[model samples]
Target: MSNFAILITRRQFAITATATSRTVAQRVYVGKPDKISNIRPLAILKNKNDSPLETQLKELQMDTQQWHHKFWMNHNKMFSKSREEFDEKWFAKKQVSSSNQSETTKMLEPEDMAIFHRNFLHNNLEAQRTYDREWKTRNKKLLFLSAQVAFQRFYFKWFKSFFSRKS
Candidate 1:
């Protein structure tokens, strides 16, 4: 084929592939009484401010890293549960509930569930990474605050020097 003909063929394939894929508008789906292939729609959070949960958490100083660690470590009893409950309830059970089901049956081979596991593991790792980064950031701020609170080396010197400099 000529170079132009090859270009045209490639363009045709690009157009076809793009056309076949779902777009954002299609995200608002008319789901069948059937299995889902993609993400479930999220409920809109109409009111962003003043959730009861946030208020309760704040009263417990949950924003502080130590408090958060203590709260989670204590409250997440499954953290030290038998391995089966830990795996079955927290990890594998998520896939079962998240999967779409019909009136009578659910899809067995809708997609290989390993992809879901792969995605979940990837997400879990990313979340842990972000959590570590935030903890480091918070620790830096706390360290700076402690230094400001306890260190007065420059304060007395600056105050005494300011008057002398004017003279």
Candidate 2:
């Protein structure tokens, strides 16, 4: 195994040990759809013909900012680091034996583990390194994100209005 791969493995172990001491399985987000009480498109713009030129223009401009601010304010808090009321129970440490403690863990040797790790890195490292690379890449095709999200509130408010009017 190369020096770089060893360093990464060491760092990963260190972070996992410091942040969480369990053999914490891979972190996965379970996509659970919320139980909606009501599912209806919001009223947005009035009918294209009925609304007066000046009034519609003024309403759209004001509604757009309101929608954008509301959405962005909500989005910013997803990765919040609030410690208003400390939750130390979750961070409490637990005892963990070394991997070789059990008979099952005893089967693997340092050399074999190192070789397996190297193979794993070679096969899967590209995905692990993507976020660090995505910004640097000039292949615009690879940057599959859209700027619409920043403008989502504005766009959706207008959209909801149009769709609601049609129905």
Candidate 3:
């Protein structure tokens, strides 16, 4: 009975292996060559005789973007530094309190890191909430300002065209 089962298993394995090899062999690429011109690139801003107002607006946009990027970069750096300090302090405390100093001084396991993360988040929850609220308010104001600028530009263009046509 065992020999019969072994024979059946070997036959099934051989069948699956051959089937998979046949499917792989059938998956040859039979498509046309790709065209480089089909790919679309990002828009590049060009200063092609833009008006003074347009230039200033562009500069303002760039400056705000830079400020936003810098803020996030600095925030991330601060968060990382704080996390590292927390980890070090916690590890040191554990090492001092633990009777097995050598074991406690070893690298933190995933579970230990998780507990530290929870504690860190709990400690900074209020500060984090405040930062998030301020960020959201700033972003909302910036968006409104942008919309106002766009509407003003559109209205100015329409007014100029109307007067020009009358003249």
Question: How high is the CA lDDT of each candidate model?
Answer: 0.39, 0.35, 0.53
Candidate 1 C-alpha lDDT tens digits along 58-128: 33332453444543454333333432343444434446543432321333333534554565556467655
Put down candidate 2 lDDT per residue, 122-159, tens digits, no spaces.
Answer: 65566447633643452242222223322443455578
Off by over 4 Å in 2: 1-105, 123-146, 155-167
TM-score on alpha carbons, each prediction: 0.29, 0.21, 0.46
* Candidate 1: residue 130 Cα off by (Å): 2.2
Ranking by TM-score: 3, 1, 2
Flag the better candidate by lDDT, 1 or 2: 1
Best by TM-score: 3
RMSD in order of candidates = 22.8, 23.3, 21.0
lDDT of 3 at 39: 20
- Superposed Cα deviation of residue 97, candidate 3 (Å): 16
* Stretches of model 1 off by over 4 angstroms after superposition: 1-67, 74-78, 86-123, 153-167
Arrange candidates, best lDDT first.
3, 1, 2
